[model samples]
Target: MGRRKSQRKNVAMLDSDEDNSSVSSSSTARSDLMSVSGAGDVQVDKDSLLEQALDALYEKRGSTREKALAAIIEAFNTNLRHQFVEKKFATLLHQCLNSIKKGSSKEIALGCHAIGLLALTVGSGDHAREILEESVAPISHALKSSSDSLKTVSLLECLAVVTFVSATETEETERSMQIMWQLLHPKLGSNVVAVKTPAVVVTAVVSTWAFLLTTMDGCSLNSKDWQESISYFSTLLDKDERSVRISAGEALAVIFETGIEKLAAENKTTPDGSILEGNKYRQGYTHILGLKSKILNQVRSLSAEAGGKGSTKKDLNSQRNLFKDVLEFLEDGYIPDISMKIGGNSLHMSTWSELIQLNFLKHFLGGGFVKHMQDNELLHDVFGFTPKRKNILGVEHQMTSGEKRMFQSPNSVLNKARTQFLNKQRMLSKDRNVGHFAFGMGDEDSR
Candidate 1:
């Protein structure tokens, strides 16, 4: 009876486990179906979704318009563009133009931004050229009549974007480039460098120039304009925006590929430095190499770019700094000799920069700012180097005793004070304890 009861219990446990497993499997299957169903629901027709977004975009509230614009971008991303573009781009372009004409500054900016994405997607086709041709009137009007700098910036951005469309007709690039120059003529000629223009506008202009160069790959048929553009961009190396500097660099790079490459290769060089002293570039390319060198060095430098993100005054990294050569220039012009080995009896001495560095370090360590520091004795090792007193370059340097007191002194004031104390102690020792005795010591003033 007991054995039969145990078997019945085991069989009941197996039946319960099977029931739980079946229930879990059904739940898992239902969840998978629901997830798939949710994705399919999201993958609705792009046209209907875009039309809905357009309606939402045209709502009265700016907040609603923002969401609608965002939704349109999302739809564009999902639709693979060319397919959906063929279907609804005409409608989308019409909406954007209407928005630019009738919408607020914010709406206009979004519309212009959307056009950039659309241009990038349909890079080379009649679609791009058509949009570029059609935008000239409204954009030109906006540029002239819009009191809002933001709106002007938007129109400029849109024009810049439209030019990326790779027009498929003869002389289209030339016409596009000329129209762009006219539109940007005012801002590009300003004396304030880049301070007057927004960073986005500068970026747009620069990238547009680069795009122009990219489309026209030849012996730079318009070398004069290219030179003027290159010169203008060279001034932007010191702009307050990293993106602008980057854009300028990119534009210059495009020009370099087109025109300036051969000139840089023909410069004279000295063995000691990498920089070429004589810039022999023709009038068109004179400043290009200098600017190019700066740009190349700027990117690799660890120095914080002005107005760059999270930068502070202490973010300087000078290990590979190219402009450190400027210091050499200063030294050569002002310094008679480096004094790397000043000598009294043919002994080596400190370099001039080394002495300055030492004095500065001593002052820094002894300053009140470091008064609360701990373990400062570690800095004592810096004083271990002994500099000799001798004239450099075989020229005798004239110095008054007071002047000599300043530079010829040991670099550390603490070491000077310690030496005086030790000398006084030794003198006192000789005077005080010749015959005196201590409790268990040989003399009362022994070391």
Candidate 2:
């Protein structure tokens, strides 16, 4: 019985020794594969091998799993730095992103790490755009994954790349804008990771929107789609997240700046007519004029209500920064040019003059008033009227009794007097021309 037990023990020892030797041999082989390097080789094959090893580790346990992850990350970093001229490197990146899409939780995490590395290397080029579109599905899926850290960090990195590369093209800009809209819209519900991601993604979206709005050419601002987007962003400003509030504020500024010209244009005409005879234009103008005040008021109220707890200063600063863009647009000739009609009629000059005076634009050299004057040469274009370069300085010192009464009267009475003056001027010019012709005919008969 003792001899039989010894034989069994010897067999167990031999099995244990073989197992140890196999593990050591496997570790050494993995180490050699990881360490292999070549000159002028962008390490594309290395990344693929590392990815395969990581896939294997998904089913692995204990120390093998840690080594697998380390190898994958190291390989990704090396390939990310590889020259763009190398086709193999690009293929490897695409492969890695794809693998992440198909990976489980652990694999997905490593994939996000790879994504971050790729983002740092990709430039604003066609290659970058292709990669971005290809990775969008995967990154979006990851965003909805239950892993908060992986989703948040990976989506943030992806957003940065998309925004940076697509800032100049309208189609690209619009596509990215749609994605951002989806991310921010409250009705889309919440992603698994968004609840904990703060508003980094929101900030990136706002920044990208602003950049595109400011840079794109011939971009229309009156689309209902943009209005809905602005509404979504506005709602985010009221979110419990401070980052979201600030980001929303910045985005509002961008929209207002880019859309201000369109708003002013809309305010210059009515749907049924070519002029502002209706109050629709006025109402639209009033709404736009109130936006700044509303935003400022919100900032003040939030500061007061928060009682030193929230990020009141950051919010205020963002509002102020955004307001600067609006002010710049206003200073630029974005205000409505109310002095002239599309068909060249200025019978409404009084109304336009009043608007200019009210807006304090007449005193400025460049604004809506200046733009109108320059565009139509309004001073020289009116029928039967020409403005003197110099006003009649001595005559204006005298005032009629009616004129004195007008000075003391209300605006309505003053307007009525101005209308009467225009009517009388028109009639007198007609009478003077008729009398001159009659006098000339009588003189010819006497001769």
Candidate 3:
């Protein structure tokens, strides 16, 4: 009787049809999984078995996350147990989030996996979307807090799942994308490699691009897409991380092929391609064209040499294989019916325009642009809205009266110009006052 009762506990996947999940149905072999609650020791204290598991999950001392993980995974493993978690999904999410933030490293790992699994299997219904909304909290925390590569990888894997599954039609999609990028951009530097390998970072990045695709409902391609992600990928061609560079090359090749095809189609068949002087899209195709031209030459040039000492053609071929596809695809003049599901990321089109106006094409795009950039801080006043740096800092050294403004320094060109203008005004005022003084009304004589 006890054995039969144990079999009836709620511990399984969100919806266990296995139709959409990458995990095989055969992988779940535990028929008496509820037996894991210690056969008879895990006496039910709550109305639901899953709640009982949660109670155990938050126990003050000596409680292992193994039980909590097993119970949650079991809930996600089969169709029957999914309802229990769904009913208490909010509680379930909170417990997992708490584990991620405050639990031991083992607990944190399980929490990461749990959130990932929820994202992977949670159906995209209204309630499911609500549950998914909770993902941003853990992801934000994990990205900032992960101290090691494996832990970072776990968090990134969760991100991959979240991005993949949440590509549904919704108002939240764009907001989520923005938030993800804001969090991701800061963590993409070489410093991330201190926490994780370059390949792991690349995989996380590729997963992010899955969200950048225009095919995702309610999302469309933007210029920033190229700047934020694709541009970075282009520069990675020369990175020490061979796998990262190779992956970046593949992405660039797809983008180049797709872009040229789109431009050609617009001009050839679309009756009115009068969008710009040199391109059909707008006056903005220059950067795309420039990027396309440079990347092709750069990748082709890479193939001409057996790079590194004693490297064979095989070595060279493997390294530049992505470019081989680009070369063949271009030579054949082939355009596919469907474009690759990827786009770029940037703060705004203005950021690109600013760079271009700075003669970005004639010179290298700049080492600063290649490295870390926060949209808010980097371009708060891209064209100088605030006082000059020297003006602000030089104020203290002068030791002037309190009346002078911080920006009113003698060193600044603008300040010098302002001072000349002010002196001229003061001289004119003195001349006018002299006339009034000499003309002598009764008050002037008294003075």
Candidate 4:
């Protein structure tokens, strides 16, 4: 009776175990289904909202289209919508271009901004090429009509980015740079007074021009093409605006680093560091060195600049910091090495080109900078940065059941060997147990 009661108790426990397991399994299944459903819902909603914004771009009211563009820009800043871009790249590009073509100053600025973000989002290749090809004419037209500083800066930034990504030939890049340059220092034929551009516009033009200049082959640049640029930048250093001075300093640094330095290194120099006599590039080399001396003196004075009235300490400190770097690079040939931590990974920028590209994109992307740095493949390729892959919760990932099966498939040679080893162990254990049982039985019978 006791044995039967024990068996009944065991049966009850097994039934209870089965029931609990089934409930747990059902709960887990529901949770997983809900998670997947929620993700799908979010993606669908985002797409729907974007579609609405795109439709709004076609509405008759300018305000409505501007608001639509603001919505689109915010969406892009919030997340990289790769699927949406792949599907509607051309449509969005053309619509933004239309805004540039027909919209007011504010609308044109917003449109230029959106197009730049689009080029950055799409990155390099045929898409970037198409962006450049489609945008140049419209942007050039807008620039011709736009006297607004904000609008001009936006258009200039858009042009620089598209060219940076897609300009395969040196001439193509230089063409965009020339357009930016002409905004500040237009070539005049006689008796024409140069309209004084706003200081902010001047800074933007110089900075964007330098940004594109970073990508050009230093050797391919003719001495005549850039000789005037050095002098112009030197003159810009004396501008009253600190921002303009800083921009000019950076452009000078890039020229020294990318172009003149490369030229100097290629040519033979004396042990005293003077250019060898009779060298083909001797005249140009001498000219650059003379300009470099002037720039170095100006940079030194700026680096040690005393705070003056009307200049905010923030701007003052910024100018000092940049000029100090310029001074260091000019005197010692050491470019700035920067390391930034993003999503637990370190991104290092040791070259001026990388620094310029990063700063441009960062300023352009605004709040979206960190998100793109973490996940944008184009940025990764550009900087040679590989960010750690993260799941939705931003934690290290674990294998799913499917992944486990994939790695531990029974058909694999390693798995097959492991299975055979376990089977052999089981057989040996059974044999050993049988021998012990038989030995015990003999001892009992003998007793």
- State TM-scores per candidate: 0.47, 0.46, 0.52, 0.75
**Model 3, backbone clash pairs (residues 3+ apart or across chains), number:** 17
TM-score-superior candidate, 1 or 4: 4
lDDT for predicted candidate 3 compared with the true structure: 0.43
The regions of model 3 sitting more than 4 angstroms off are 1-36, 40-55, 61-63, 74-81, 167-171, 187-199, 211-219, 253-274, 278-283, 297-447
Clash totals, every prediction: 0, 0, 17, 0
lDDT of 3 by residue, 1-447 (tens): 011212211121222122234222322313223443443444442225555566666665524555666556555433223445456667777777787777766677667766655543333344345556777676667767765655665565555445434445434445555554554455466555543335655544543443233212211344445445556776777666555655565555444422333333342343453434444443333445446555656667655645776656664675665455444333332211111110122222111112221222111111122111111111122222121122365532322233233212122212122223223322332232222212112221211
* Per-residue accuracy of model 1 over 64-120 as CA lDDT, tens digit each: 666567556544432334555666677777777777878888888777766655654
- Clashes counted in candidate 1 amount to 0
With a 3 Å backbone cut-off (N, CA, C), the pairs that clash in candidate 2 are none
Model 4 Cα shift for residue 259 (angstroms): 0.4
Q: What TM-score does prediction 2 earn?
A: 0.46
Off by over 4 Å in 2: 1-85, 104-113, 116-124, 141-150, 166-168, 186-218, 223-226, 229-235, 238-240, 269-286, 300-447
Ranking of all predicted structures according to TM-score, beginning with the best and ending with the worst:
4, 3, 1, 2
**Candidates' lDDT values, in order?**
0.45, 0.41, 0.43, 0.68
Q: Tens-digit lDDT track for model 4 on 357-388?
A: 77788788766676667656556556766655
lDDT of 1 at 115: 69
